[model samples]
Target: MNRDQMEGNWKQFTGKAKEQWGKLTDDDLDTVAGKREQLEGKIQERYGKTKDEAKQEVDNWFDRNGW
Candidate 1:
Protein backbone atom coordinates (compact mmCIF):
# COMPACT_ATOMS: atom_id res chain seq x y z
CA MET A 1 0.00 0.00 0.00
CA ASN A 2 0.96 3.60 -0.35
CA ARG A 3 2.24 5.32 2.76
CA ASP A 4 -0.94 7.24 3.51
CA GLN A 5 -3.13 4.21 2.99
CA MET A 6 -0.83 2.10 5.09
CA GLU A 7 -0.83 4.56 7.95
CA GLY A 8 -4.59 4.80 7.79
CA ASN A 9 -5.03 1.05 7.94
CA TRP A 10 -2.09 0.04 10.04
CA LYS A 11 -4.19 -2.09 12.38
CA GLN A 12 -5.75 -4.08 9.58
CA PHE A 13 -2.44 -4.74 7.89
CA THR A 14 -0.44 -5.80 10.96
CA GLY A 15 -1.61 -9.41 10.84
CA LYS A 16 -0.73 -9.66 7.15
CA ALA A 17 2.61 -8.06 7.83
CA LYS A 18 3.34 -10.65 10.50
CA GLU A 19 2.38 -13.39 8.11
CA GLN A 20 4.64 -12.01 5.42
CA TRP A 21 7.59 -11.43 7.77
CA GLY A 22 7.28 -13.79 10.67
CA LYS A 23 10.64 -12.72 12.09
CA LEU A 24 9.15 -9.37 12.98
CA THR A 25 7.85 -9.13 16.51
CA ASP A 26 4.69 -7.40 17.62
CA ASP A 27 6.88 -4.69 19.10
CA ASP A 28 8.49 -4.24 15.71
CA LEU A 29 5.16 -3.69 14.05
CA ASP A 30 4.13 -1.27 16.77
CA THR A 31 7.33 0.63 16.29
CA VAL A 32 6.95 0.71 12.54
CA ALA A 33 3.40 2.00 12.92
CA GLY A 34 2.76 1.86 9.16
CA LYS A 35 5.64 4.04 8.20
CA ARG A 36 7.12 2.74 4.94
CA GLU A 37 10.65 3.82 5.82
CA GLN A 38 10.48 2.09 9.19
CA LEU A 39 9.08 -1.06 7.64
CA GLU A 40 11.82 -1.05 5.03
CA GLY A 41 14.45 -0.62 7.73
CA LYS A 42 12.98 -3.42 9.77
CA ILE A 43 12.93 -5.70 6.77
CA GLN A 44 16.50 -4.87 5.97
CA GLU A 45 17.55 -5.44 9.56
CA ARG A 46 15.69 -8.72 10.00
CA TYR A 47 16.24 -10.11 6.52
CA GLY A 48 19.81 -9.01 5.95
CA LYS A 49 18.77 -7.17 2.84
CA THR A 50 20.30 -4.11 1.24
CA LYS A 51 18.24 -0.91 1.35
CA ASP A 52 17.39 -1.14 -2.35
CA GLU A 53 16.41 -4.76 -1.96
CA ALA A 54 14.14 -3.93 0.94
CA LYS A 55 12.50 -1.12 -0.96
CA GLN A 56 11.89 -3.33 -3.98
CA GLU A 57 10.50 -6.08 -1.78
CA VAL A 58 8.08 -3.67 -0.17
CA ASP A 59 7.05 -2.37 -3.55
CA ASN A 60 6.47 -5.89 -4.80
CA TRP A 61 4.37 -6.67 -1.75
CA PHE A 62 2.20 -3.64 -2.33
CA ASP A 63 1.72 -4.67 -5.91
CA ARG A 64 0.91 -8.25 -5.01
CA ASN A 65 -1.64 -7.22 -2.41
CA GLY A 66 -3.20 -4.74 -4.89
CA TRP A 67 -2.87 -2.08 -2.23
Candidate 2:
Protein backbone atom coordinates (compact mmCIF):
# COMPACT_ATOMS: atom_id res chain seq x y z
CA MET A 1 0.00 0.00 0.00
CA ASN A 2 1.02 3.59 -0.63
CA ARG A 3 1.38 6.40 1.91
CA ASP A 4 -2.09 7.70 1.18
CA GLN A 5 -3.57 4.29 1.78
CA MET A 6 -1.61 4.01 4.99
CA GLU A 7 -3.04 7.33 6.25
CA GLY A 8 -6.52 6.50 5.16
CA ASN A 9 -6.31 3.16 6.87
CA TRP A 10 -4.61 4.48 9.96
CA LYS A 11 -6.57 2.40 12.44
CA GLN A 12 -5.44 -0.82 10.86
CA PHE A 13 -2.05 0.55 10.02
CA THR A 14 -1.38 1.67 13.58
CA GLY A 15 -2.30 -1.76 14.91
CA LYS A 16 0.13 -3.28 12.48
CA ALA A 17 2.69 -0.69 13.41
CA LYS A 18 2.40 -1.58 17.07
CA GLU A 19 2.75 -5.24 16.28
CA GLN A 20 5.83 -4.58 14.14
CA TRP A 21 7.44 -2.22 16.62
CA GLY A 22 6.63 -3.89 19.91
CA LYS A 23 8.42 -1.10 21.73
CA LEU A 24 5.78 1.42 20.65
CA THR A 25 3.01 2.06 23.11
CA ASP A 26 -0.64 2.75 22.34
CA ASP A 27 -0.16 6.30 23.58
CA ASP A 28 2.52 6.89 21.00
CA LEU A 29 0.21 5.77 18.21
CA ASP A 30 -2.58 7.96 19.53
CA THR A 31 -0.20 10.89 19.81
CA VAL A 32 0.73 10.50 16.21
CA ALA A 33 -2.97 10.76 15.38
CA GLY A 34 -2.84 8.83 12.16
CA LYS A 35 -0.50 11.23 10.40
CA ARG A 36 1.97 9.16 8.45
CA GLU A 37 4.87 11.55 8.93
CA GLN A 38 4.18 11.93 12.63
CA LEU A 39 3.90 8.18 13.01
CA GLU A 40 7.24 7.80 11.26
CA GLY A 41 8.75 10.44 13.49
CA LYS A 42 7.38 8.72 16.59
CA ILE A 43 8.65 5.38 15.39
CA GLN A 44 12.10 6.85 14.94
CA GLU A 45 11.97 8.49 18.33
CA ARG A 46 10.88 5.28 20.05
CA TYR A 47 12.86 2.74 18.05
CA GLY A 48 15.92 4.68 16.95
CA LYS A 49 15.27 3.71 13.36
CA THR A 50 16.19 5.81 10.36
CA LYS A 51 13.33 7.28 8.31
CA ASP A 52 13.90 4.94 5.39
CA GLU A 53 14.18 1.95 7.70
CA ALA A 54 10.89 2.70 9.41
CA LYS A 55 9.17 3.38 6.13
CA GLN A 56 10.54 0.15 4.75
CA GLU A 57 9.28 -1.76 7.81
CA VAL A 58 5.81 -0.26 7.48
CA ASP A 59 5.71 -1.04 3.80
CA ASN A 60 6.86 -4.55 4.51
CA TRP A 61 3.99 -4.96 6.95
CA PHE A 62 1.53 -3.76 4.34
CA ASP A 63 2.82 -6.34 1.92
CA ARG A 64 2.61 -9.13 4.44
CA ASN A 65 -0.35 -11.49 4.60
CA GLY A 66 -2.90 -10.85 7.39
CA TRP A 67 -1.38 -7.46 8.25
Highest lDDT: give the candidate number.
1
Tens digits of per-residue lDDT, candidate 2, 1-67, equal 5556656777866766777788888998887766767877877888899999878776676578443
Cα lDDT tens digits, model 1, 1-67, are 5678899999998998999999999999999999999999999999999999999988988888889
Alpha-carbon RMSD, each predicted model: 0.9, 2.5
Q: Enumerate clash totals for all models, in the order shown.
A: 0, 0
TM-score of 2: 0.68
Global lDDT of each candidate: 0.93, 0.74
Quote each prediction's TM-score.
0.93, 0.68
